[model samples]
Target chain A: MGLKIIVLAKQVPDTRNVGKDAMKADGTVNRAALAAIFNPEDLNALEQALRLKDRYPGSEITILTMGPGRAADIIREGLYRGADKGYLLTDRAFAGSDTLATSYAIACAIRKIKHFDLIVAGRQAIDGDTAQVGPQVAEKLNLPQITYAETVKSAEGGKITVVRRLERGVETVEAPLPCVITVNASAPDCRPRNAKRVMKFKHAKTVTESQAQSEDYIDLTNDRPYLNIEEWSVNDIETDMKWLGLGGSPTKVKKIENVVFQAKESKRITNNEEELEAMIVELIENHTIG
Target chain B: MGNLFVICEIEEGKIADVSLELLTKGRSLANDLSCKLEAVVLGHQLKGIEKQVFPFGVDVLHLADSKDLEIYTTLPFTAVIVDLFKQEKPEICLLGATTLGRDLGPRISSALQSGLTADCTSLEIGDHEDKKAGKTYKNLLYQIRPAFGGNIVATIINPDCRPQMATVREGVMKMEVYNENHKGKVKTIDVDKLLKPEDLVVKVIERHMEKSKVNIKNSSIIVAGGYGMGSREGFNQLFQLAEVLSAEVGASRAAVDAGYADHERQIGQTGVTVRPKLYIACGISGQIQHTAGMEESAMVIAINNDSNAPINKIADYVINGEVNDIVAKLIKLYKKNSK
Candidate 1:
């Protein structure tokens, strides 16, 4: 039987290419200054979902993301890459959500969507680097989770085999289906965007984005229902206001320090054992080594 | 209400090293906050772990000995920790940022609705004032870590939630060995009632024992290369030097990205943190990301053309020259001296 796959993705500010304005005065990320790109490992997760769709024929892939209104761009990018449709869980109440609250809100939205046999996401987001969201969602939903997954080897008979890339090496383990899987960066690179798909999804927009459009596209959106991306707000999803946003986030930033390394006075040495021996002996004498 | 808890993850019937580090660090925090330090060990038949952990400054050693916890699975371990957390509203909780901790800590904190920090390099007890939130918290766990991928060091506080949870990187804190003659109370926790039948969703089908790979974090000697190495051939010279020095080969993220090395060999913030005895750099302009991984190396010797490279800041000795030239000369000298 073909499965229903939900690919969780995020449009994170490109932290890898951080510039001077990447951090704000409050030590938080400056989302406006840096270019926003799809979280790299999430693309790898998407590739796994697409591969599973190819094998399972009728399997559907839905890209789900929680961000500001602009994050619908991530869903359009996913559509061009092979996602069937997407849901953007955007709300003012969800702002400033830490991992715990973020997962809580997302879980509420997932309950609204209702049907999903599998959920796949990147092992960790580059910006947060916490790797907690996927498993936290699994826990909230009481589902089994496989983290650091390198590949999905097989999926048959209500079970899925996953190869994990651990600190030591690799592990091949099998788990029951309807479980969550977080993919690693070492997994196969995602395929390039197809030109035909890009042309087809170029006009895709969320209701908010469509409202800002000068062109009259309401009829086009109504004619091709896939062109409209689903956007949900706090009111749309059944969630407690106390468990959303800054009110719910327990972690607080006490302080932040800007650190820059300055070089110490380096000694010049010729390539010889006498010089090396002398340095080594001094290091030993200084208790730096034995 | 004012107690520090360290989850002592047991492996191969012994407390993991990171657990000891947390306990050692937690003891000072407990003293700072005028509280007691407790360590939790969960497994089937712990085999006299209390005697080993008591000396680490634990006032109360809690054990949850059950068949379900022989090998760590997230569900059972999370159930045990959260159940204990609900009963004993500990102010601060710490766990090693190991595979097991990373998997279990989030679930525990989520169930408790507490804040959980991951990969914290430093932890302290401090006062937290949030101007934006308009509140001040006293005696909070200030979890410090290199944020923005090691570019900035940020201090995070979970003042609003009880059991301010944090997962510490291994080897970040020094382990303490207190007087073993001292006695502490030991309490056994029952986990049978806390777990649900549906929580047993995952079963270990097969566990193939692969030959344990050499971990760079534990390597006594490391020869780390960087982007300046130019190509794979330049990395070969570093390998030769490592062969002579009997050191592990590590690479900065740049070299790993340049396709000269594999991701496993990467030494940096996003990669692996190492505390080698000696660290030798070749062609590596040390960024904070790379240095954060191995800055604790007992001795650092940097060889780079750019004398002003940031890596030279922490390096104990700096050699200015081409990496290939220096590596070859070092290899020859090492061989000759041993002979």
Candidate 2:
């Protein structure tokens, strides 16, 4: 039997080339300044699922992302690759969630799926760098978690072998199937969008995204169910109100201070051999480096 | 609930450096909150190791010594700690953001229905306001960390959650041994009751512990490279200088992302936070993401072709030259001077 996989993806702002206006005066992120893209590491996780699907032939890949209504774009982006179906967990109730609340919301969504052989997630999001959500979801769901997974060696006889990248070196471990795996950036890069797949999924949109547009999707979704990226609000998922959003999120932003590094004066050093030698002697004498 | 607690990790019959660092930080925060600074140590036969926490200002040390608690497994350790936290109800909890801490911190926080902030760079005991709830919180743990890929800093607080928790990055705080002798409360809780047999679900078949040649975190000197190095082969130059100085080789995330170096050697917000005495930046453009990792170094030397590279701002000595040329000259000079 082919395995069922769920790839957890997030739409995060590209933070590599942040400019001056990246943060507003009040300390919250100025979303408009930075373009939101599929979180880079999530792509790596998706690649792992896609690779497994390739091996298992009939395996299915689903993308589950929790964010604002606009996060439906990540689902479409995943579909453009090789994902079969997508679930967008959205609602205003999920605002200001820390990793704990985020994982709770995600675990509930996974519960709704009911049956899956594996759940793949990025090791951490660049925005938070917490690396807690995937493992926490595993814990909340009472599933075994293999984190920092660089490669999935094999999945046979209801057992999965994964090679993990640790601080000192690589480690190979095996856990029974239906476990959670968090991918690291060291994993294989995800394949680019397929021309044909993009054309097929370009019109794929969540209900909210389709509602925002003037185009009518009533007939399209009825004819081609794949064009509909299913959306699940808090009400759709059986979630307690106390554990959904800001009230459930214990961590709060106390304050934010803008920091700018002031340039320190440095003595001009020439690159000549003589000056370089003299500077080395001086540094050695001062015990800077020997 | 007013007391602050630190989860002290033991390695090789002694407390890990990160645990000591958190103890030192916890002492300051405890002083600010006017409560006792307590420490919890769980391990097998942790007899004499519990005393070392006293000099660092731990008013109480709780040792849950057990054979099951050894080897740093997530199950029993989280069980014992969460059991203790439930009974003690500490106002704040701190641990090192290492592999064990990252795993245990979340489990405990999630189990208790509290909030946890990971990889914090700084901590303060202060007050905060809830903007949306229209309320004010007093005497909270202000956990500050890099957000948005180190582009901005956000101060997170667990205002509504009890026992606010945070995992601080290793080496971000100083670990100093106080010479003065002082008496502190040391309690050994019964471990058998805290850890349940059912909690052990995972088993380790084998653990390959390789001793890396470059223990960058403890190294006094570091030679760091960035994307400016161009390719993985360019890292050989950094390794050469590191070999000469007996230093560790490090890289920015850009280099790691570009497949130029392994992720373990990455030094930045998402990687290791090192405070080496001498840090030589080769071709590192020094975005805040990279510098935030090594900015605490005693001496920083930047060698980049661009004179206005961001690394130059924090560098004590800025050399406006190519890394290949400057590194060659420096290595030659050092070899010659030694001879």
Candidate 3:
């Protein structure tokens, strides 16, 4: 009675803590300046999947992420926490993918990893903030979706209940198995990496990573089959060439402009009683504030 | 019909303010394109919903009043709107970037293979020429939004897609009435014919949607804080200052993410946009994300220990001081001066 769960995750630039150098003078993102980490809400999604695995004994969690070869880091990170396995969906064809094309690629990968009772993903990535991929993936796969989920109330009798944290309030909803659920940040933070699991999975690497390693490392992976993280490309999944990349994307970026604020002629006020009182008096007289 | 369509959202049996704002925007966009402005509402007890939107200059109102459509499940609503868009072939489609609209908009776009831009800050009708393809698209909806963590503003377009789609957050567009006497035609949808049994798979077990207690959007004066506030305990001074000035408390997304303030009070690209008469920004460095929400304030006062804080660039008065000390001083000075 073990349920199979696939958690869709991403390695996104840490946009939340963007620095002055995070953007280039050319108005493009300076990706090298931003640290790439497992998307925050995706960790929330992982925590939900882990909780479900705890409730359903023997439930297996698979971390599926789409990015460059280095995205394997998040997969290993997932394994170090509690997931049983991971897959990296990487290819040149995925470059310049908007949410729709990204979801199409992920949905195709999910189909290849079929036989799952549930699919989980973060409500939105911090970088894009579109919050579109989860529902789009559900539509691409023709599955029911519950977005903004704060908690998984239960999963029993072939049905799952989730509490969604909406803008105004919360809602409790139930959908049958084999559906998509996108977790919100309001959900509990993911549990810390397990020491034992980390020791066991520290050497996990994708095929590309394995090729770059020493022969001794390759031998270790052969001895430990679980160390191999699956890597899939466009050829690995059945996909239409029309829906694979920038050409497949319906939306196009016509222009991008760096944010430059027009400086106002501001009056500088010292932090003293006299200046502060004088400013307050002027505001009161002008009716700007009482 | 190459009309401009707005998908209306309902709250407490009334048309939400965001929907009306979009209707106002749709009216103008439709006029620019010389096309009709249409609105779609799906919910129960929506008998007089047209009355709510007609003043916004909607030329046609499509209503699908059904018990199943009331609470807003994904599948059925998507079925109805996707079905409607296919038949009508709208030139542009807009929806409020709320929980309901974000949930439904992507599904419809994916089903129809159309482009959708989320959380747009501005929408304009313009022309685009693809230099490589030697093609020009006229009157395309420019979906402008702050991207890459609000570091840059991008203009998105759907050159080849039918029914260019975009979602704007509440308050991003102003809600204005086109005419008090404006009237529109109503067309009821046949939900039963569109929805299959599988569409009813998800069920709402319970729902508790309370009106937001904080009214920051309409507040004329806002005392906003940021991550520099240090902690929740540090925010008490801001609350006291807001009370003295008869202002509402707002926060930067950084402050909200730091757990120093509530999410409802967040002011940024991702949060509520406010244009208060006076904005007293304390301890905020003024990232574009935060500034995009409140930069439209009539007057601004920036108080931070860092004199070089980015917020000072936009402020009418810049005070170099600690947030707690400066806020306390402002509260005391304002109280004494008023008396």
Candidate 4:
């Protein structure tokens, strides 16, 4: 039994640098203005997984992501950076899923890929910053999970050790095999793409993209296999249909509005000794100041 | 009766300060919803915990006593909470947004298939309208948190989920007054069968606490230098000002990332949220993330070379000058005033 390490990666819109056009008419995200990149923290997660493969020579590292078909760009980037395999879970049925529904789909895919030693995810996705899906998938799989892991101490003999970043300090702990660990930004920074590997897998395409390319019927490059991730539809996984999408999701977005913070007009009271005392008393009475 | 569940976390027998803060905050929410405030304590033979929780306003305390539960573990701790939530349907669940809370709250909430809001800065009771029933429900718990890189405050509510959950950062709420005569009931839970050696997959071999030369979080007077603190030598000047005031040193995210100071002393969204009585910003550009964390400080005095810096807009008093000159002047001023 060899070690099979899989990382859950997401290509999110560049939220840190959101511009005016980042919002649509409905106040939903206008993803067009946002350039998609491998989520910053997920890069850290992928680096850790790559390091694991580095330490244990024969271990296989696969990158798994769920997004639109355009997300294949991330898979190619993963391949260019030494992942042995890439799996993309994309379907129109998976749209409008929140963190819970997203986790259900990812967990189903993770379970389908049996005999995996460890799963790595970024502490939280930048888009929602919910920090729910990673741990949620771990719970669904019924595995012991370590979150905010700063470093992986060891992974051997059906056991894993890591240092979790705490508020005041860090706690070092070892968990049994088949555990889920969410890597924090404090994890060692990711390595740059391997140019040789990039040249080898740059032409890799998804099954749908490849089929589309075949219909166009023009071979652009003869470098590497057009590696398209096996896209699975709703019927691909064994899950309760009732618990899969909008039906299974118990929560819904009531509404999203631009929250503007504005300071209230202040009736400036003179800074006299008596006024200060009176203001303090009034503040205490109103429960605004302690 | 619906119980307001307060997940009280303790470190070394003494309940964590944030837990008390949560208890105080929970008291109002529980009262607003007409529910009983319950404290859920998990540790190894902890004694006198119920007595301490009284002033914080807990009515009942659920104690889970076990040696294995002494150290924090995701498996057993989460399992115990899940079972408790199932057995007791709490209307609102509160946890301190500490390291342990952030690590455990999401897992438990997800396992129960409920909504869990993290790092909430403000919370209150409001009216939520039911879409299906087309009626307004009064006294719905409102969980307000900073989002969009802390650009604005978004209000969140768990409409369908029975227990409205939120993990608030420490220092965001004030602790209640402590009274000696206060009292509450403590009940010990025996779940040895549910928790076993296999459940304890994670083991802490050795725990080391870092020695703090200057922990800004607890500091009363903090001299915080930001990106405008030109270089390492400039930060040292702020440190000197702190030393003269007998205060602690702090830095903005930019300064910390620029390697001017250690990350431990960072004060912002990605850093520690501080509410010191007096906060002095030296040459710091007031980014939203930094302002979001420190806006609650009692008195803010911003010293920036740029008179128009955003930090000045929110500052109670703004001193316009170079950080070096301002820090040097402040150090000299402190020495003169103290002497």
Candidate 5:
């Protein structure tokens, strides 16, 4: 058995370049104004995990994501990129989940599944950038954790070796099995979606969900719905309701305001030799250039 | 009154410089809050760290010395800190936003069920009526960080959570005061074998440390190129200029994505946030993401063919020209002036 690795992925809005109309009157992000894409760094994490699978052949890569129905796009992306299997954890109860609550649900789902040799996640989700979920999951799962991993040097004989990017430099550490690693952007770029693999797994889905999608729109009646992903609700996860959602999230947004730059043109010096020298001298005197 | 806690970190038995930086910030916060400063050191039979904390203005040193705690693990670090948080209940907890602190802070806060704000640039104590109580004077710690990709500054407060938490980026603050008269107490905590060898899912098999070629975060001068550089060859010119000037090379988000250089050299909201003395942007349009990271630099010189670009708006000197020509000229000029 080569290593079995699982990657937890997320689909987030591209908030880096939002327009003036990106915010609604109620002061919440207008999801419509933003285009949804797989979180960029999460793709890096997925790529790192897939690279591990490639090195040690026979290793199976599983992708688990918790998002809305449309998040199935990420699963398609994952499958296209050589993930052996993709599982979606979707339900209405998981809506409005903060990092803590979301990590709880994912941990429960992971606990329900079979054991894996390793788990990987992006350093942080762009939407929140809390960077809390990965470590929190490791803590909840009782696994050793390493965040900001740029490269995985080796993994063999129940031992995993990786390079950790610290502020000043990089530190190489080898941790025991079943460790959770958070992939930083410094890692290798994720490979492009493989065309042949996409075609092969195009039809793959949970048995019931595939059948439901196969049904015609008119034939859909007031009948029982399908349980697609073995998704557990807040109760199904054996979680306290008080420890979920906005109620559980201690941080509150008193206000959400768009930051506007008050452009103050201090002094625009020319790039001439004298002017450049003078500007540098003045900046140092003002303690701005230092 | 609780003392400010500064967690000391060491790699290969050498004290990390950022630990000293945190102690400096902690001492100031302690003075503002009218409390003493404390340093928390955890490692394997490390007794030398105690003497060092004194120069850093630590009034009390909490030591957790053990063999199992040699390498940083989530369980031991969290377990030890949670115990300290319960016993001490410090007013503020600050950690360097390094790899270890990023991994450890959240778990500790989650275990304590407290609020933690990560990657903060500034902090202060705010005197306001307790929002929870509506009309009671309370000293709430205000943790401020650049959010929305450094376009906005968000001030976060943990009014209810004890030990209001925040992580500061390395090199963003000063080092602690090294006063010879600084006297404090050192209390050693026992990290008993609460965790088993089997419980650790991940084991350290081997370790490697690669010395970085360029420590951009600590560099005083940075020469950044962007997509407007026109070609990959043009970016190479910027690098040549960086070599001549003894400056770190940087790029905008588009430039990095375009394969001009590695992602580590990219400077912007998504990349490294930097504030160098002289930041020169060549052939780059100033998008918000790119601007957010470099806007804080002391003197920004934007060289772009298009004078109306946003880079021109924020730059102290807007060189309206082609980047390749301008960079080549600047290199020639610098060489001549140096002689």
Candidate 6:
């Protein structure tokens, strides 16, 4: 029998390529300035899932992401890369969520999806750099988790083996199926978007998105059910209001300050031998370096 | 029962440095809160582990020794810690943001429905008055960390959650012995009773913990490169300078991402924080992400072709020149002077 996989991805502000305009004058990040793209590491997680599907020819891969309506783009991107279906967990109740609250919402969605042999997610998202969601989801689901995974070696006979990359070394571990694995950047980069797959999923849209589009687009989705990406809100999932949004979040932001460095008085010196020697001599004399 | 806790990690049968660092920080926090500082060590053959942590001013040491925990596994370790916290009701819990802590901290925080902040740069006791809620929270643990790709700093607090949890990177805090003669009480945890068979679902087949070849955090001097290093071959000049200065080699996150240097050598907000006495930055533009880790260095020197590089702002001495040429000169002058 083929395996069932759930890949968790996020659409994040491109923090890696932040330019001067990325920060506004008030010292806050200008969200409008940064381009939102599929989080780099999440793509690595998707690649691992794709690899597993390749190994198990009959396996099906589903992409699940929780964000704003625009996050539907992540689902279409996944579809263009080879995922069979996708779910967009979009709701205002998910706003102001810390890692734990975010994990709770994602876990509730996973329960709704029900059957899955494995779950894969990036070790961390660049926007938050908190590698908490994968393991927290596992805890909420009461399943084992293998984090910092560099490669998913094999999945067969209800068991999965993964190579984990740690700070100083690597370890290979085995866990029974229906577990979570957080992929690290060391894993292979994801394959680029397939031309045929892109053409096939180009029109995929969520209900919220189709409502804003022309009637023809709605008709297209009705005719081709595959083109209608699943969108879920607070009402769609079994959730407690207390655990849905900012109220359920245990952590709160007390303050945020824009990074500003105090400029020190630096002594300028040329690259000439005389100036270089003088600087080196001063450093050695002061015991700064010897 | 309400106390401060530091979850210690074991490396090669000894307490890890990050854990010791947290204990040092925990001792001060405990003193400020007028509470005891407790520590927990869950591993196999943990005999006499208390002797290692007591010097850091830990008031109580909880030990859970079992063969199943000889090597760190997620489920069993999480089970033991979660079970203990339910009974202790710690006011604040700190863990080293190592591979082990990052994996276990979230699980524990989620299970207990508590707040957890990861990779905190600073932790302090502070108060918060929520005008909207018409309430005041006294002595909340402020979890301060660089966010927004290191373009900003955020202070996080878990006012309502029990045992406000936070994780700090390995070298962000100093590990100082509170008192060599300090002593603490020992509490033994019943690991078998707490751990269920389901906790043993994941099995470790093989683990190779290599002794870290680069000791940058403890090094007094560091020669670091950045994206401007151009290629892996360009990094060789940094190694040469490091060898001459008897210093360790480090790299910016950009260099590591470019595959010019190893990830372990990355020095930035996302990597190892360092406070070396002398930091020679070669070809580094000094983004906040990179400078956040090394800004605390006792002295800094910048050698970059761009005179306007942000690193030049923090450097004690700035030299505008090609990195390759300047590094060669520094090496020669240092060798001659030392000789």
- TM-scores of the models, in the given order? 0.91, 0.91, 0.99, 0.87, 0.83, 0.98
> Which residue pairs in model 5 clash with each other?
A172-B208, A174-B204, A174-B205, A175-B203, A175-B204, A176-B202, A176-B203, A177-B201
**lDDT by residue for model 2 (B7-90), tens:** 988777899888999988888888788899999998888878756888898888998988777666676777788888888999
lDDT of 3 by residue, B1-339 (tens): 399999999999899999999999999989999999999999998988898999999899999988899898999999999999989999999999999989999999999998999999999999999999999988999999999888889999999998899999888888899999999999999887788999999999899999998999999999999988888998868999999889999999999999998899999889989999999998899988899899999999999999878899999999998888888888888988999
Q: What is the lDDT of residue B243 in candidate 1?
A: 76
Tens digits of per-residue lDDT, candidate 4, B204-297, equal 8766656546667788778898878889887888877787666788898778767898878888765678888878888887766687678777
Per-model DockQ against the true two-chain complex: 0.50, 0.56, 0.90, 0.28, 0.33, 0.81
Would you list the C-alpha lDDT of every candidate in the order shown?
A: 0.83, 0.84, 0.93, 0.77, 0.74, 0.93
Question: Which candidate number has the best TM-score?
Answer: 3
Could you give candidate 5's per-residue lDDT for residues B193-253 as a string of tens digits? 5445553444454455655566777788899988887778878898888887788999887
Candidate 6 Cα outliers beyond 4 Å, as residue runs = B336-338
Arrange candidates by DockQ, descending. Answer: 3, 6, 2, 1, 5, 4
Docking band of candidate 6:
high
- Docking class for model 5 is acceptable
| Predicted candidate 1 versus true structure: per-residue lDDT over A69-151, tens digit per residue | 88999899999999999999998899889999999998888888889888999988877789889988988887888888888
Grade the docking of candidate 2. medium
Number of clashes recorded per candidate: 0, 0, 0, 2, 8, 0
TM-score of chain B of 3: 0.98
So what's the TM-score on candidate 3? 0.99
TM-score of 2: 0.91
Against the true structure, whose DockQ is highest?
A: 3
